[model samples]
Every structure is written in C-alpha cells, then in structure tokens.
Target chain A: DQQVKQNSPSLSVQEGRISILNCDYTNSMFDYFLWYKKYPAEGPTFLISISSIKDKNEDGRFTVFLNKSAKHLSLHIVPSQPGDSAVYFCAASTPGYALNFGKGTSLLVTP
Target chain B: DTAVSQTPKYLVTQMGNDKSIKCEQNLGHDTMYWYKQDSKKFLKIMFSYNNKELIINETVPNRFSPKSPDKAHLNLHINSLELGDSAVYFCASSQDPSGRVGDTQYFGPGTRLTVL
Candidate 1:
C-alpha cells in the first residue's frame, strides 16, 4: 500500500505563472515532509521541506504548505520558469525510518 | 565535487548472473542508504548503514546483500539475479537522522540495471 500519494500525474503551467502541486498521505506518524526535483537524466535533489509543527515553509520562489488535519501538503512555485519543469516528488519521513516517496508529478512549464 | 558517485552507471546481464554496484560519497557523512526505483517509478529504500554498521534492511530478498566497508562506501550485491531485479538503483548519504538540516540525503546519478 502506498502511504503517500500524488493524485496528479502531470501538470502544465505557463512561464511566469504560479504552479501548485498536491500530495496526500494516509500515515499520520509522518512528521517531516520533503519535496525533490528531478530532471530527465538526473536523480532527484532536495527542494523544500516542512515540519508538522509549521503550516508553511518557503525558499525563494518555492513554498510548501501543510495541513495536519487533512494529511495533505502542497508545493507551490511562483513565477514558474522553464528550468522548473521537471518531476516533483513528495516524500515523508518518520523518526528513524526511511523516506516514503510518491509516484511523482511531472510539471511542464512552457515559455 | 561529486557528493555521491556510483560505478557502472548502466549494467545489462543475464537473469542468472551475479553483479555488484559500487557507491562512494565524499560528503563525509555517517549515514548512507540504497534505494531501488522500479518500472513504475516508485523509489523504495532497501538498506541503510551508519558508520560501517548496518541499520535498516527492508523487505528485500536474501539474494540482495548490502555492504559498507567504510563510512563513505556502500555496495550492493545481487546473486542469481532475476528478471524482476531490473531497475534503477540510487545511493544516497545523509549527516544523521536526528532531523537536522544536514540530514537531507544527497543522491547519485543512479545505476540502471537490466537483467534479461
């Protein structure tokens, strides 16, 4: 069973627009939520993360919002650029456990 | 500097063959892990080691073994590989699992293994 799920398989956004990706989890024990970006031929790299205590976390043009009650989280990229076009994975980590990754959402930012 | 590097980026072998994939990290971290990405693009952790000691082993088969000769090195060995063994394997490292900022794991380019 997949503890984490990304309902959207792909997303398309125009350049200089805002892009929002959604993720949901069934496990409430997961306290750490993280986002990773991956290119065509490269492994995923860390993007942004949020703790269960906080509702939102931001890094530059990227922001992550979490709703503990709903067991959902989202990654937002404001003013999306062409380079931001890639697969985005939402992962969760429980204490002393490995990260559980979603199926990933491919984002296409057209110029 | 390449934080994490894996050898034999691409491997193609027969179903009954045995093969090993090597990984090295220069990030000077104490924790390392191996993950397998299947055809469905699901990345799952197989093993984890900290300072040359095995810490976690998921529900993988006994044919698969992980070795950590040192803190910076982790290797995976598959014996009598099966067709289902074909997948992309990634090696990653982190500072510690103390939930610190540096605990963010860095992944390698990945090694694609095709077992026919």
Candidate 2:
C-alpha cells in the first residue's frame, strides 16, 4: 500500500515564478515529513522538512507547509530557477521508523 | 568528497544469477539504510542498520540480504535474482543514534540493477 501519494506526476513552471508541489498521506502516525530532490542518474537528496508541531518551514527559496489535520503537505519554490528542475519526492515517518516515500513528481522550470 | 559511495553503478545480469552491491559512507554516521526504487518510481526502504546491528527489515524477499560489517558500510547481496528484482538501489546514512525520524539522510548515486 502506498502510504504517501503525490497525485501529480509532473509540473511545469516558468523561471522566476512560483512552483508548488503537493503530497498527501494516509498514515496519521507520521509526524515527520521531508522533501527530497533527485536528478537523472543520481540519488534523491534531502531538501526541506517539517515536523508535526510546526505548520511551515522555509529555507532560502524552498518552503514546506504541513497540514496535519488534512494529512497533506506541500513544497513551494519561489522564483523557480532552471536548475530547480528535477524530480521531488515526499517522505514521511515517525520516530525510529523507516520512511515511506511517494512516487515523486517531476518539475520542469523553463526559461 | 563523496559522503556516500556505492560500487558498480550499473549491473546487468541474467535471471537466477547472484549479485552483490557494496556501499560505504565516510560521514561517520551511526545509521545506514538501503532503498530500492522500482519501475513505478517508488523509493521503498528495504533495510536499516544502526551501529552494525539490524534495526528494520521491510517485506523484502529472502533472496535479498543486507550485511553491515562496520558502522560505515552496508552491502546488499541477492541470491537467485529474479526479473522483478531489477531496480535502482540506493544507500543512505544519517547520524541519528537517538533514532530521530527526521534526521537528514545522505544518499549515494544509485546502482542500477538489470535482470534479464
């Protein structure tokens, strides 16, 4: 069963615009959420994360918003650059547990 | 410097063959994990080890086994590899001795396994 889901398989955005990717989960026990960015032929790398206690967390141009009541979270990239084009994965887990990852969404930032 | 490294970036073999993928991390982390990205692009955790001790084992087949000789290395050995076992395998590490779930994990460039 897929506990984490990223319904959108792909998204396209213009450079310098906003790019938003959404994810949902069925497991309520997951208290930690993370976003990972991946490129072709490379492994996924950590991007940003948010805890259940906080509703939002931001780092540079990347911001993650979590809504526990809805079991939904989102990653927003402001002023999206061409270099930001990559596949993004959403993962969730509780303390001491292995992470559950989504299928991932591919983002294309066009100049 | 590479924080995590995997040997044999690509492996192509016939079904029923046995194969092994070696992984190493120089980050001085306490925990290591193995994840498989299947054809559907789902990155699923297969196993985890902490300080050379097994901590988690998902519903992976018995043909797959993870061996951690030290805190810095985790290797996967597959016996009687099947066609469905073909996928990109990733090795990851984190410094979470306390088992914090959100600790950032560093991943190695994946090893793509092909079973014909």
Candidate 3:
C-alpha cells in the first residue's frame, strides 16, 4: 500500500510563474515531510521540508505547506525558472522508520 | 568532490548473472541507505545501515543483499539477476537517525541496472 501519493503525474507552468505540486499521505504517524527534485538521470536532491509541528516552511523560491488535519502537503515554486523543470518527489517518514516516497510529479517550466 | 559516489553508473547484464554496485560517502555520516526506483518512478527503501550495522531491511527479495564494510561504504550485491531487477538504485547518507533531529539524506547520482 502506498502511504504517500502524488496525484498528479505531470505539471506544466510558464516561466516566472508559480508552480504548485500537491501531495497526500494516508499514514498519520508520519511527522516529517520533504520534497526532492530529480533530473533525467541524476538522483533526487533535497529541496524543502516541513515538520508536522509547523504548517509551512520556505526556502528562497520554494515553499512547503503542511495540513496535518487533511493529511496533505504542497510544494510551491514561485517564479518558476527553466532550471526548475524536473521530477519532484514527496517523501514522508516517522521518527526512525524508512521514508515512504510518492510516485513523483514531473514538472516542466516553459521558457 | 562528490559527497556521495556510486560506481558503474550503468550496468547491463544477462539473466542469472551476478552483479554488485559499490557506494561510498565522503560526508562522514554514520547512517547510509539504499533506495530503488522502478520504471514507474516509485522510489522505495531497500536497506539501511547505521555505523556498519543493519537498521532497516525492507521486504525485498532474498536475491538482493546489502553489505556495509564500513560506515563510509555500502555495497549492494545481487544474485541471479532477473528482468524485474532492472531499475535505478540510489544511495543516501544522513548524520544520524535517532529522531532527535530531523535528518536530511543526501543521495548519490544513482546507478541504472538493466537485467536482460
């Protein structure tokens, strides 16, 4: 069973615009949520993360919001650049357990 | 310098063959993990080693084995490769996983293995 799910398989946005990626999880035990960006052949790189204690966290152009009641989270990239085009994965983990990753969403930023 | 590095970026072998992928991390982290990404782009953890000791072992097939010679290196050895073994394997490391601090796992470039 998939505990974490990225409903959207792909997304497209114009350059300098906002791009929003959504994620949902079933396991309520997950307290840590994170996002990773991946290129065509490279490994997934950590982007942003949000703890269950907080509702939101931001890093530069990236922002992540978490809604514990809804078991939902989102990653927002403002002013999306061409370099931001890549697959984004949503992962969640309990305190010490292995992370459960979503299928990933492929985002394309058009120039 | 690569913080985490893996050997044999791409491996193509026939069925029933045995192959091993080597991974090394220079960050001096005590925890290392191996994750596999299937064709559908689903990433799943296969094994984790902390201080050269097994911490988490997922319900992966018995054909797959993970070895950690030291805290700095973790290797994956597969016996009797099958078509289902074709996927991208990623190695990651973190400072600690005691849950005291939210750990960030740094990943390697990845190794693409193809079983023909």
Q: Estimate each model's TM-score.
A: 0.98, 0.97, 0.97
Stretches > 4 Å off in candidate 2: B97-102
lDDT of 1 by residue, A57-92 (tens): 999999999999999999999989999999999999
Error of 1 at A3 (Å): 0.7
> Residue by residue across B4-27, what tens digits does model 2's lDDT show?
999899999999999999999999
Q: Candidate 3 — which residues are off by over 4 angstroms?
A: B98-102
* All models, RMSD in angstroms: 1.0, 1.3, 1.3
Tens digits of per-residue lDDT, candidate 3, A1-111, equal 899999999999999999999999999999999899999878888888888999999999999999999999999999899999999999998887878899999999999
DockQ, per model, reads: 0.64, 0.63, 0.64
Per-residue alpha-carbon lDDT of candidate 3 for residues B9-116, written as tens digits (9 for 90 to 100):
999999999999999999999999999999988999999999999999899898999999999999999999999999999999988662224568889999999999
Decide which is better by DockQ, 1 or 2: 1
lDDT value for model 3? 0.92
Expressed as tens digits, the lDDT of each residue in B1-116 for candidate 1 is 89999988999999999999999999999999999999999888899998999888988999999988999999999999999999999999998752345589899989999998
Which residue pairs overlap in candidate 1's backbone? none
